[model samples]
Structures are given as structure tokens and as C-alpha cells.
Target chain A: MDIIEILFTASFWAAAIRIATPLILATMGELICERAGVLNLGIEGIMVVGAFAGWMAVYSGTGLWAGVAVAFIVGMAFGLLHSTLTVPFGLSQHVVGLGVTLLATSATYYAYRLALPEVTSPPKIAAFQPYEIPILSDIPFIGEALFSQTPFTYFAFLLVLAVAVVLYRTPLGLAVRAVGENPSAVAAQGLSVTAIRMGAVIVGSGFMAMGGAFLTMSAFDSFFFEMVNGRGWICIALVVFGSWRPGKALLGAILFAAFDALQIRVQQTEIGAEIPYQIFLMMPYILSILALVVMSRRAEVPAALMVPFNKGER
Target chain B: MNLRKNKRVTMRLEPIENPTMLRRLGLPAAVLAATFLVASLLAMIAGANPFSVFGLIIKGAFGSKFAVLETLNRATPLIFTGLAVAVAFRAKFWNIGAEAQLYAGALVTVVLGTGLLPWPAFAILPALFVCAILAGAIVLLVPALLKTRFGVDEVVTTLLFNFIFLLFISMLLEGPLKDPMGMGWPKSARLIPEARLPRIVDGLRLHWGFALALISAGLVWIIQTRSTLGYEMRAVGLNKEAAAFAGIPVNRVLVKTALLSGGLAALAGFSEVAGLKGSLTLDLSPGFGYTGIIVAMLALLNPLGVVVAALFVAGIFVGADSMSRAADVPTYLADIMLASALLMMVLAIMLTRFRVVRG
Candidate 1:
């Protein structure tokens, strides 16, 4: 009816939560990788492969859980490739990440065509449904948004807390952060920098893949070409916007998701009928760029980012 | 010279001051072989016959006159984009917005070609080309400025600008620039005959654009090796702090090279529009900008090597398309092969520069 009413509705918040889930998942994954000094541009392609893996598993008569498991494993494989190139081979991270993305996206498309063979309508799977927490569901406005969500959404929120705690509190977390800042110092302390980086990549990539699996499993039932729709790239921006903190990253995800939800809702209203919808789609990206420019001064980029560590070199 | 005899020193790995020609060539060859083996395994996993697919690719890319011409035609735009990428990467600018810059060029050309200018038939192509290059460069000016002035990361800024350009183009096509007589399709009006690039041959689709691509490559090589500007750019690329210490204007070098890079990438769109399509449309570039990065990297950002690398990369893509049609293998096999090849090439280059020592 009215703009304020539209923004405040329960349905709007639910939509925002739903839209934000994948972004949160991706941001969480990217935070770990960036924290460890790897910019995995392969997230886009990994997500596509993950989406495909989940879709194929379900299409091939497996359960939804099995599909998600397969997706996570597939994502980790790409992470391993990135690690091999960047960690041990000491190659350029930007080039390697882009190459991995191209490879994964192409491989996913090829596999989908070979296995499915039919292109009339895309194949679909029975997707994950929302599970409402019993008592939590009874609350008024925020209940539907926070309590009743796909299993993945709840897991995504829990992951934000988990990542924050692990990153700030644990020795392994300290090692990962230390390696990003000063790999030489970490090496002198008798820790395997490569091992820690490799672990961070694999774990980060698993979460990235889970984000994709969630898309196919919960966001929508079927896969399509470019369904990830630059969310992986958005996640890259979010990592910077969030200032590499899990709490801030989640807040950024929610902010983006809210705008996304608003766009979809506004597109259907009478007042929004006159405007071109592309403007709405462009909002999040434009906002992120502005935000990055403003926050870049204080943002703590890893000191050793994009630099390959040669153990003996200055 | 110590009174007590020192323990004999063991041999240690040292970085070579200059590698021989043979090592340079052999390392790349080995890397190619390793990547091929890996890609073959991937193809097998995808349920295709790897040997047959490889054979088909070679045959389809270069087995006949028709295939060779097609490969070159596909390679025309890549050469421009590759050079664009090589130029920026040589200066260490890393402009990833070539795709959008290409679109910007195409947009300028389309707007001008569709009755914006009254230039004579003989002058339209050159005018459009120049304008498009300027438009492409202008589109990147903001990012370059931000990068130099504010310490913003060019990679992110350029990428965000790409989405902006694409959306802007989509808006134009769907709103003001829609074709008036395509029976409701959202296409632009075809370019006038005078605006089209003349074909180089009677029967083949190859145009004068191929010559432009070659000349651009040669010019890039000359500029990179012989010119003062190129020297400054390279110096900046190697180390900004050192270049600044050496009295080079690092910011000027970065901004100017980025403009040139964007201009070169835009020329690709100009060639595609004038030579092949003769009009603007959605999906004009099949990720040529991204592929350009691969081509440049495969050549190690050497300008002359870019010519060979672009052709090689284009051949795989074109050949894979043919193979998919003829042998029923998907075109994505080529992508897997290309990715592995790039990975291996970069790995080989790095490995050749450093050797392990037994301490």
C-alpha cells in the first residue's frame, strides 16, 4: 500500500533474510580466505560448480543432503587447485583465481549438457523447505524473519559467530592472521605457513561451495546458466566492505539483501511501474563501490596480500 | 685464508641472471605437455574420448583452409583485447574492465553510425574507430583517477564499472535505441553500408581488421621495447617506489598506460562491429576481454608473443566449437584445457625463475 508499510511488513523481512542467506554464506567463506591473504576469485565458478553438483545429485535420484555434501567437496577441489598454484608453485593469485573460475564454470556447463542432454526446460529438484523453530516462531515481527528459515540460513548465522570466535580466540586463527600479516615471522616461529594457508583455503572454499549449494537447494529448485549472477563478485566486495570482520560482513550482507528485497517488491508496485528495473539491480553494486571508497582508508587489508612467499626471499 | 681450514662450501641454488634460449623454450613446452595430460584426464572423467577430442580439436582448428580462416576471424578481436591486457599488465595496471570498455567502444560506434555524423563514406570507419577508442578510454578515466588519487584498488573499481556499463547499454537498447523495424525485437538498426569495413577477400569473411590487429601488435612491441613512455611504464610496473626514486612520474605512467590499454581493448569492439557484426547487439563479446588476460599471460605479457598466444587460444575455442558439432564433445572441454594450460604456463615461468637448493 504505502512505502513505509511495505518496508515494515513481515514478508519483506522474510524475503530479505532469504535473499541474504547466500550472501552471508559466501561472505563468511571469503572472510577466511581473505584473512589468510588469498583472494579467491574462483568463488564465482566454485559456486556454479557447487550449484551444479547439488542439482545433479538431486536430479540423479539422491537426497538433498547428499547433494549439498557433494557440492562442498567439489568446491574444496577448486580451493586445492588455487592452493597448489599460489602456495607451493608461487604463482600470481589474480591470474590463477581467474583461470580456476573459467575452468570451473566451463566444466560445470559441459558436465550439465553431457549428463542432462535435454534443454527444453531446465531440470528441477524438490528443494529445501523452511523449518520453523517451535517457540521462536511464536514471536511477533522478527520471528518469521529470524526463526522460520531454511536450515542453511540458521547454519549461516551460526557460522558467522563460529568464524568470529575462531578467528579471534584460537591459536590456529592467530597463526592464520599472523601468516597474512607477516609470513616470514610465522615461518621463523616454527609453523608451516603453507600448511596453514592450505587449510584456510580448503575450509573457506568449502563454505563458498555451501553457499552455492544453498542457492540450488533452498533459493530455487533448478539451475540455469549464470544463476550465481555475480553474487560471487559481490561477495568479494562485501569482504572489503565488511572490513574483514565476521560481524560487519554479516551486517553488510543484510544491507545488500534488504536492498535486493526492496527492488523485487518495488518492481511489482504501481509507483515502481514507471522506472526501469535495471536501476534497481544496479543499486547494490554502486553502493558497494561508494562504500569501498569511503572505508578503504581504514580497512585493514592483509599486508602480504597477493604476494607469494618465497621462504628465503625478502 | 683462515689458519684453520674452513669446511668446503656446498653448492647452492642461485637465481640465474639470464636464462638461455633453450631453457626458456623447453620449460614452456614441458608445461604445455603437463597441462595437456591433466586436461586429457578431465575430459575422460566427463565421459568424452580424450584422444578423439584432441585430434578433433587439432583438425578443426587448422586442418583446412576454411578452418584456418575461421580461426583467424575468431582471433581478430582477441588480438586487440590481448594487446590491451598485455599493455596494462606490462605496466602492472591490471585493468579487468576490457569487456566493458569493449562495450563502451561498441556503443559509441553504434550511436555514431546510426545517423549521428554526416561524414563521407570513406571517412566514417576511421572517425568511428577514433571516437570509440576515446569513449573506451574515457570510461576508464574515473577508475584510473580514483586509483591514482585516492589509493583505491583499480581491480575492484574497474570491475564495478563493468556492471555499470553493461546495465547502461541494456537500458539504452531496451529504451531509446531499440530497432524501429525489427518486428519488436530489441536490436539496433544495422549500420549503413558505408560504415561497414571492406572485406579483404572476395569469398571469406576476413576483413581489413586483421591487418589492423597485426599492425597494433607490431606497434605495441616497438613501443614496449623502444619508446621512452614504454620504458617509464615498465619501470613503474617493476616497482613503483623505485620508479618514483628514479624520477619517473609514476602516476602519469599508470594513468596514461591505462588509457592506452582501454583504447586498445575498445579497438577490439570497433573491429568486431565494423568487420563482423556491422551493428550493436547484446552478447557482442563472448568473454573476449577475460580471454584476453589468458592470452596475455600465456605470452608472459610480451607484445609479439601476444599475437601467437591469441591465435593459439582462439584456435582452441574455435576448434572446440567445431569438435562439439562434429564429434559430440562439448565446447567446455576446451575451456578446461585452456585453464590448465594457463595454470601450467604461469607455474612453469615461476619455477624457471627459482630453483630449490639442498641446504
Candidate 2:
């Protein structure tokens, strides 16, 4: 099929939305963390732990929602460890974040081996199936593309809106934003900057794990190694692309997913047949670098991002 | 007057003007004990006796002459990558793309060593080494330039480059670099015997790469302690604004640091292929670049310490692999131990300069 013909198909849009589901969730998660002034480089490994935890829970006969909860809680446990070191000890965020990633990933792998020692291939669980909304499903083109998705996709979209509201409309959001921009100002206001930053990291990390859980529970049926495959890092770039805004970050996720879907389809076409498939696989990372270069020039980074705040220190 | 006031005691970290020798030594010992405790807990969860597991690991690492040599072989690449990370981190450049640079070096090695060079072994070997360094240097230069000119964050860009470079290498392996006579495998053609690194001793599996690594570590130590560029890098890392004020070209120093770091990491790939593997494959590195961060951190970013650190890290992996076969626990326990060690070491380093005081 030609490029234009592919773009017109509802399947393409449906695939793009499906692809964007995890990115949307994870980007929102990262946006929250960055907005709160902590760069969670642990996103990648936390996502791995999430994928394994959620899938393992479901595989063990827990309900789907319970699996998600399991993933979120486990992710939060790691986040607590992360925040404890970064916030209270005021360790180098870069080193501590990477250490957390290493810890989470290795711990997950060890757990997976202990849980399923005999199986060569990962066993599949009955994952979340697509749910068609009553009226929205009947719309001509848009309905099939957006409404007819797994409950996970719907939750991801709703999260963007909810995050946007909380970030701009609520007092808690203001405090969170204040902590990232000017922690001393927030501290002067009799608010605890440490509490806000730690809380933001913990909650934000839960969302990131849910994004990972979406892959095994919604996108695919089984947990596997390297399945998250740099999506977490892409979400980091998306936060930059969105300038740490929820709505814009959601859009960035979808746009990136669309390109991803397009590349997968393009590989099957005649023009794609002549090029090495690895070239097609490389588009997402290359595009992320381009996007980072384009947006970083004007991106308004959090003023206190990566800067540890020691209260009462001159 | 304050004595009559309510004295609320709360713990807070206070800067220490000078740490006593015992405090410096005790903190690190405590950190090691903490890491060991965590590892023991993990072993218990895996249904293995923690003491036996620890015993197996130590025996497996240093039991036989063969085991010691195996660790030295594994440590060769780590030493290079660890030095690479230590140097860049010392400059505060955050060069996390050492994995990609290592592959870049290997790619160059295969391209030139696979009958592409018709000269004598002496000329061809040096040429291949120089080209590998150049390739790795160029790969990292892109991100460094982006950071310097476009105000981009090197962390994300460098991380992204790892994925991109891997795909690029995959393309080459499947297309042009594909071994023609070998069975279907995504690997490059083997290097000529002339291009290979000589074994350190006859009948010994160890190669000259280990010697090169030791020499490299000594050279790096000298550079870090005795060179002007090393002084500039330390100044930049300590305080960028102050370094710039002191007439150091901060951006230029960062770019130069990237080249040196990338080149050092590339040597790992070169050594792996030239000294042992002789052919390039996708799994040439099992996350050596990422593991280098652990090594660098554990060493406190000290150049000579990186050598000792790399050896220690390699022993764990070599030991863990064997221990897994003899025990019920998974081999990834090594990774968990090292990661915890990294975190604990960083915290301990901080405690050496700052004391938590109750007020």
C-alpha cells in the first residue's frame, strides 16, 4: 500500500493509539517527576519491574486491576528507596537514579527466574481485551481509532486530562510546581519542600510502572526481557518536547507513536523492501534526538531541577 | 538564655571541616557490611543458605588458576569502560554512551581487520587501533557538540545514541558485514591472525589486552593526577561557574573530555575483538557500559581505583555465573549486590565530608 492509502486506514490510527498508550502514561509520569524537580532516570528499570510484576500477578490468577495495583505498589517501593537517598541523603541524582535502575532491573530478573524456573518461554496471561464504548464506538472513523481500545488506553487518556487539571487547577499542583521552580520560596511559605518532592516522585513512579504494566497487560499477553525497549527513555524526551506540560506531553506521545506505527507499516511496502529493516527500527530513537534538539532550545527547565534543597542552609 | 528555651532535637547533616582517619575507614566498611547484608537477605529469599552462597562465590572467583585468569579476561573490557566513565564523570560530562562508542570501535575493527588491510601485521595493527579510537571519538563527538552548541542535555542524547548505534551496527552485520562463508548468523567476518592481539603467555588463555588495560589504567592515573587537562576537568566538575571564571574554557574542556572518554571506552571493544573474540557480534558487551557506571561510582571516580574496582566487579560476575550452576539462586544477584554497593558507597563518601548531627 502507498503511504497516503495507509494513512487513511482506520487500522493505522488504531495501531498508533495502541502504540501511544504506554508512552502517554509514562510521559505523564515523567512530566510529573520533572515538574516536581527530580529527574527519575530510574524510569527505564522501574518500567521493567512494573511489566514483570503486573504480568506475574496476572499470571498467578490475580484480577487485571489487581495486577496493575501490584505493579504500582512495587514501583512505589522502589521509588521510596530512590527518594530516601536522593531527598534526605541528597546523593547525586544521576548516580542514585542509575543505581535504582540497575537494582530494580536485576531484582526483577531474579524474581522472574525464581517464580518460573522451568519455563523457557514466558507464559501468557489473559490480558485486558478491547472495550468498545457504547455511542463512541459507532462514530464513522474516529470511533474505531480511539474508542475501541483496551480499558488501559482509555485510562491513559483520562490520566492526561486529570494530570492537566491537577497541575493547573489545584493548590496541591501549585505547591508541587513551586517546589520544582523555587523550593526556598515554597519552604518560606511554611510548606515542606521535602515532603512535596518525595510525594511527587513516589506517585509519579507508580504511574510509570502502570505504563510498563500496560505493555504486558494491554499491548501484549506475556512478559519478556527488553520489551519496554527504550520507551521509558523516549518518555523522558517527550517531557522535554512538551516542556513539562501534561497536555502537550500527551500529544508528543501520540505523535511519536504515529511515526512508530508508520514505520512498522512502511517496512512492508515496496520502497521499504529495498532498505535494511534495521534502518526502519532506528527511526524512533533518531527522531527523539531530533525532537530533543528542536525543543531543548526553548524548553523551560525547572529552575531547581537536579538541585538538592537542604533546608536552612545558606 | 537558650538553655531555658525548648530544645527540640532533630538530626540534620552538617559539613565537616576534616574527617578523622578512623571515620573515613569505618564508613566504607559499614557500607560494605550493609551491601553484604542486603545480598544475604536476597539469597535467603531464593532459598539458598547465605553463608554457602557467599562461600561458593568466593571459591568460584579465586579457587583455581583458571578462575583467576577468567576474571582477568572479563575485567579487561570493564577496566577500559570504567576508566572511560570515571574520566567523563570527573569532567561532569555524563557520557553514558560508552556502550555505543565501544560498538563503534568494534565496527571499525571488523571493517579493517577482515582482510581490508593488506599491509604487514605491525602497520595494520596500529592503524586498526587508531581508526577504532577515531570512530568511537566521532560517535561521542556528535552528542558533545549538541550539548555545547544546541544547549541539549547529553544524558538523553547519549542514551538515545546507544539505541541508534546498535541498530546501525545491526544493519551493517546483516548487510555488508555479514560473514559470507559462515552459517547464517548476524556476525561480522573474523579478523586475520595478523590483526589479532598476541596471547600474554604460551598455553595461557590470557591475552595482551590485560596488559594493555593495566598500562592504560596507570596512564589514566598519571593523567588525572599529573596533567593540566586533568586539573581542568577536576575544576570543571567541582564548579563550572568558578572554572569558567578561572579562565578555563568549560565547553571546550567538555568536548575534549568526551573524546578521551569515548576513545577509552572504544578500547574495550577493540580489546574484546582483537584479544579474545576475533569476530564482532551483537552481544559483544553484556551491558559493560552501564556496569561501568557502577564501577566508576564504587571507585569514587578515582582513576587507579577503577582498576581495582573493575577487578572486583568482574570477580562477582564470574563468581556469580558459576555459583548459579551450583546453587538455586539466580546469577543476577551479582548485579543487585553491585548496585547496592554503588548506592551505599556514594552515601558513605558523602558522610565522610558531612556528619549527621542531632540539634
Candidate 3:
């Protein structure tokens, strides 16, 4: 099929939304962390831990929602370790973040081996299935593309709206924003900058874990190595592409996912037969760099980002 | 001003005027103990006796001549990558694309060594080495330039480049550089015997790459301690604003750092393909670029210390691989140990300069 013809198909849009589900969740997670002035480079490994934890929980006789809760809690536990080092001790975020990633990934792999020693193939669990809304499912092509998705996708969409409202419309959001931009100002206002930053990281990391859980529980049934596959890093780029805004970040995720879906379909066409398939795989990373370059100038980074705040110190 | 409102007593860090030698030595020792403690806990969780696991690891690492040589072989690539990270991090340039640069080096090695250079061994070897360095250097130069000119963050760009370059390599292996005579595997053509690096000793599996790594480490130490560029890099790392005020070209120094770091990491790829495998494959250096960060940090980013750190890190990996066969625990315990050691070492380094006081 031609490019325009593929774009017009409902299946293409449905695939695009499916691909964007994880990115949207993870981008919002990263947005919350960066907006709080802590760069969580541990997103990649935390996502791995999340994928494994959620799947393992479901396989071990828990409901799917309970498995997601397990993933979120486990992710938050790691976040606590991260924040304690970075916030209270005021360590280098870069080193600590990388260390956390290494720690989380290795720990996850170790646990996976211990849990399923005799099995070569990763066992699958009963995953979340697509749920069609009552009235929306009866509508035209747009309904099938958007509304007929797993409950996880609907939750992801609602999350973006919730995050947007909390960030701009709530007092807690103002305090979170102020802590990232000017911690000393927050300190002068009788607020504990440490508490806000730590809280933001912990809660944000939970969301990131949920994104990973979506892959295992919604996108695919089984957990495997390399499945998260740089989605967390892509979400980091999305945050930059959105300039750290929730609504814009959600759009960026969908746009990126569209390109991803397009590439997968393009590989099936006659033109794809002539080119090496690896070229198609390389597009997302290349586009992320391009997006960073295009938006870097206008992007308004948090003023205190990566700068540790020590009370009563210059 | 809000001290009256919040009456809770909290601990704070105060810089110590002069830390005693014992405090400096004792704290890191304690941190090491803590890392081992965590490792033991993990082993226990895996249903293995912690003491036996530790014993097996030590015996596996240094038990026989073969085991020692195996460690030395592993350390060769790590030394190069560790030095790459040390140099760049010392200049405060986050060159996380060492993995990409390493592949670029290997790609060049295969392209030139697979009968493409119809010259004598002596003439071709040096040409291949120089070209590999240049290829790796050019790969990293793009991100460095982007950071300087466009205000782009190098961390994300460099990390993203790793994925991009790996795919690019995959494309080459499947298309232009495919080994036609071999079975249907995605691998490149092998280097001719003349292009291969010579073994350091007769009947020994060890190659000259280990010697090259040692010499490279010594050279880096000299550059870090005796050269003007090293001084400039340290100054830039310590404080960029002060260095710029002191007439140091901050951006130029960062670009130069990218070149040196990328070239060093590329040597790992060159050594692996030329000195060991004689052919390029996808899994050439399993996360050596990322592991280099651990090696560099554990060494406190010192050049000579990186060599020792690489040896230590390589020993854990070699030992753990052997231990896994004899024990129920997984081989990933080594990674967990190194990561925890890195975190603890950084924290210990900070504690050496400061003391905690509860107020």
C-alpha cells in the first residue's frame, strides 16, 4: 500500500495509539521528575523492573490491577533510595542515577532467574484485553482508533489531563514548580524544598513503573529482556520536545508513535523490500536527536535543574 | 527565618578543615564491607550459602593460570573504556556514547582488515589503528558540536547515539559488509591472518592488546599529571565559569575531550576485534561502555587508578561467570556488586571532606 493509503486506514491509527500508550505514561512521569529539578536517569532500568515485577505478580496469582500496584510500589521504593542519596546527601545526580539504573536492572535480572529457574521461555500471564466503550464503539473510524483500546490506554489519556490540571490549576503543583525553578524562594516561604523534591521523584517514578507495566500487562503478555528497549530514553526526549508541558508532551508522544507505526507498515511495502530493515529501526533515535536540536533553543529548562539545594548555604 | 516554626532537629553536613588519614581510610573500608554485605544478602536470597559463594568467586578468579589470564583478557577492553570515561568526565563532558564509538572502531577494523588492505602486516596494522581512532572520534564529535553550538544536552544525545550506531552497524552487516561465504549469520568477514594482532607469548592465549592497554594507561597518567591539556581539562571540570574567566577556551576544551575520550573507547573495539575475535559481531563488547562508568567512578576518575579498577571489575565478572556454573545464584551478582560499590564509593568520597553533625 502507498503511504497516504496507509495513513487513512483505521488500523494504522489504532496501532499508533497503542504504540503511544507507554510513551505517554512515561513522558508524563519524566515531566514530573524534571519539573521537580531531579533528572531520573534511572527511568530505563526502573521500567525494566516494572515490566518484570508487574508480570511476575500477575503470574503468581494476583489480579492485573494488583500487579500494577506491585510495579508502582517497587518503583517507588527505588525512587526513595534515589531521592535519599540525591536530596539529603546532595550527591551527583548523574552518577547516582546511572548507579540506580545498573542496580535496578541487575536486581531485576537476578530476581527473574531465581523466580523461573527451570523455564527457558518466559511464561505468559493473562493480560488486559481491549475494552470498547458503549456509544464510542458504534461511531465511525475515529471510535475504533481511539476508544476501542485496553483500559490502560484510557488511563494513560486521563493521566495526561490529570497531570495538566495538577500542574497548572493546583497549589501543590505551584509548590512543585517553584521548587524546581527557585528552591530558595520555596525555602523562604516556609516550605521544605527537600520534601517537595523527594515527593515528586517518588510519585513520578511510580508513574514510570506503570508505563513499563503497560507493556507487559497491556501491549504484550510475557516479559522478556530488552523489551523496554529505550522507551524510557525516548520519553526523556519527549519531555524536551514538549518543553516540559503535559498537553504538548502527550502530543509529542502520539506523533512519535505515529512515525513508529508508519515505519512498521512501510517495511511491509515494496519500497521496504529494497532497503535494509535496520534503517527503519534507527528512525526513532535519530528523530529524538533532531527533536532535541530543534527544541533546545526555545526549551525553558528548570532553573535549578541538576543543582542540589543545601539549606543555609550559598 | 522559619527556624522557629520548624523545631525538628536535623543532621547537616559540615566541611571538615582537615580529615585525618584514618577517617579517610576507615570510611571507604566500611563502605566496601557494606557492599559485600549486600552481595551476601542477595546470595542468600538465591538459596546459596553466602560464604561458599564468596569462596567460589575468589577461587574462580585467581585459582589457576588460565583464570588469571582470562581476567587479564577481559580487563583489556575495560581499561580502554574506563580511561575513555575518566578523561571525558574529568573535563565535565558527559560522553555516554562510548559504546557507539567502540562499534565505530570495530566497523573500521573489519572494513580494512578483511583483505581490503593489500599491504604488509607492518604497514596495514598501524593504518587500521589510526583509522579506527578517527572513525570513533568523528562519531562523538557530532554530539560535542551540538552541545557547544546548539546548547543541546550531550547526555541524551550521546545515549541516543548508541542505539542509532548499533542499528547502523546491523544494517552494514546485513547488507554491504555481509560475510557471504559464512553460514546465514549476521556477521562480517574475518580479518586475514596477517592483519591479526600477535599473541604476546607462544602457547599463551593472551595477546598484545593487554600490553597496549597497560601502556595506554601509563600514557594517560602522564597526560593527566604532566601535560597542559590535562590541567585545562581539570580546570574546566572543577569550575567552568572560573576556567573561562582564566582565559581557558571552555568549549574548545570540551570538543578536544570528546575526541580523546572517543578515541580511547574505540581502542577497546579495535583490541577486541583485531587481537581476539578477528571478526566483528553484534555482541562485541557487552555493555563495556556503560560498565566503564562504574570503573571510572570506583577509581575516582584517576587515570592510573582506572587500570587497577578495570582489573578488579573484570575479576568479579570472570569469577561470577565461573561461580554461576557451580552455584545456584545468577551471574548478575557481579553487576549488582559493582553498582553498589560505585554509589557507596561516591558517598564515601564526599564524607571524607565533610562530617555529619546533628543540630
Give DockQ per model, in order: 0.38, 0.55, 0.63
How far out, in Å, is residue B24 in model 2? 1.6
TM-scores for every candidate against the unseen true structure: 0.95, 0.98, 0.98
User: Which order, best to worst by TM-score?
Assistant: 3, 2, 1
- How big is the positional error of residue B95 in model 3, measured in Å on the Cα after superposition? 1.2
The regions of model 1 sitting more than 4 angstroms off are B1-14, B46-48
Lowest-scoring 10 consecutive residues by lDDT in candidate 3 chain B? B1-10
lDDT of 1 at B30: 93
Residue pairs with backbone overlap in model 2: none
TM-score of chain A of 2: 0.99
Model 2: what is its DockQ? 0.55
Docking class of 2: medium
lDDT score, candidate 3: 0.91
Worst 10 residues of 3 chain A by lDDT: A305-314
The share of true interface contacts that also appear in candidate 1 amounts to 0.51
Tens digits of per-residue lDDT, candidate 1, A1-314, equal 77778788988989999999988988888889888888888888888998889888888999888888888889999899998788856677888888888888988988888887768778778998999999998899888878899887898999999999999998888988987889888877866667778788888888898899888889999998889977888898888889889999999999889888888888888978888877877887787778778878889899977776765566
lDDT of 1 by residue, B20-132 (tens): 77778999999778867876786677677889888888899999998998899889999999999999988889788899999988888888887778878888888998998
Per-model chain A TM: 0.97, 0.99, 0.99
Error at A199, model 2, angstroms = 0.2
TM-score for chain B of all predictions = 0.94, 0.96, 0.97
Q: What does the lDDT come to for candidate 2?
A: 0.91
